[model samples]
Target: MDRRRLLTTAVLGGAAGLVGATALGSLSPEDVWAAEGANAKINPGDPDPNFVEGRVTAVSDAVVFVTSSDGTYHSIRVTTGTSIWKLNPSTLDEVKVGDGLYARGVRMPDNTLAADSLWVNIVNLNAHVDSIGRGHLNLDHHGQRVVAHVEQGRSAAVYNNTPAVSDMSMLQAGKHVKVIGAWHPDTNEITISTVYAAV
Candidate 1:
């Protein structure tokens, strides 16, 4: 794997053989942004060909089967190099049927995605900051109120394309922002991973 994939897989991908989570040195928001950026580069105008977003329907020892929201079937192969993230670093054993999954990897000749990174129950939203509390932010996402909980010491903010920081005091109400988080299935809530906004 390259340095970018290593860092991302190490940070978001669980700590195990191939590239352990400790290899990244820290679970900083930078890694999260970088990983997402990498995936975004796949297709500028078209859909990402190397990404899969769907619900897991079946899991075997080394492969996961998914059915996307559009009913497209995907077969993903998991290897030692694959990194699993479920709110945090996790193992393949943690993957279960019905879990939401977002995977990025190489598309194989056989049509199976050779997954390098897996984010289970992850969510990305564009919303306006409705309110900011001691440990959470209320957002108006597509006219729906969403409660986003901030994880102390884990959540970070990137203001105006600047470096990521833990200081969220700069966030203002009514500002439009992008949020990357882990979703609590079937709820209007999420645990924030990173918040991107303009100062």
Candidate 2:
């Protein structure tokens, strides 16, 4: 198999085994986001009581396109003042093409949404692989220590002598890794997405 297929098999297999049989099916970025939206907690006081949850369809330097659960789409403008998970764009991995997102913001007069905060709590993390082992890896990211689970289906690629796993590998223990998966607030564990090693 090619590198992408191998990595997909490995990550999916690892997630299934680790997360349990209930989570065995493959999760598209949209699928993961949709599930999170169903359970998302919405804070009251917004003008629009009918506010909806959505996933980011696209992101650019200044705007984000959100597709809501009801099949409605909106283009939300992202200002520098917007509250994202990570302050630095380089460290921000919460919102990608396919990610679960909860956006709470104001609706503009033009019918577009102006998001104050875009929560991608359900998205996967991206990180670089600093070290690898038989069934686990240690990732260094954002001044934090993260542990990742490796399984039989997991694959690896070598970039400049550093092993890159799936997006989760971005959490290399001593290197600059970006995490883009879900963050377990209680345990602080992040389910990984993509890991990009600094060039």
lDDT of 1 by residue, 1-199 (tens): 3644543343344443465543433333346556565536654667787889999999987889999998999998776666677767778898989888988776766788877778888778899999999899999999999999998887889899998798899999999999988888778999988899987
**TM-scores of all models?**
0.72, 0.37
Per-residue accuracy of model 2 over 55-162 as CA lDDT, tens digit each: 668887656787877788877654433455421222234567765566544555566555444556444445545676545566655545666544333333334546
Q: Give the residue spans of candidate 1 off by over 4 A.
A: 1-49, 108-110
Cα lDDT, model 2, residue 58? 84
Give the TM-score comparing model 1 with the true structure, all chains together. Answer: 0.72
* Model 2 local distance difference test score: 0.48
Which one is best on lDDT?
Answer: 1
Ten-residue region with minimum lDDT total, candidate 2:
16-25
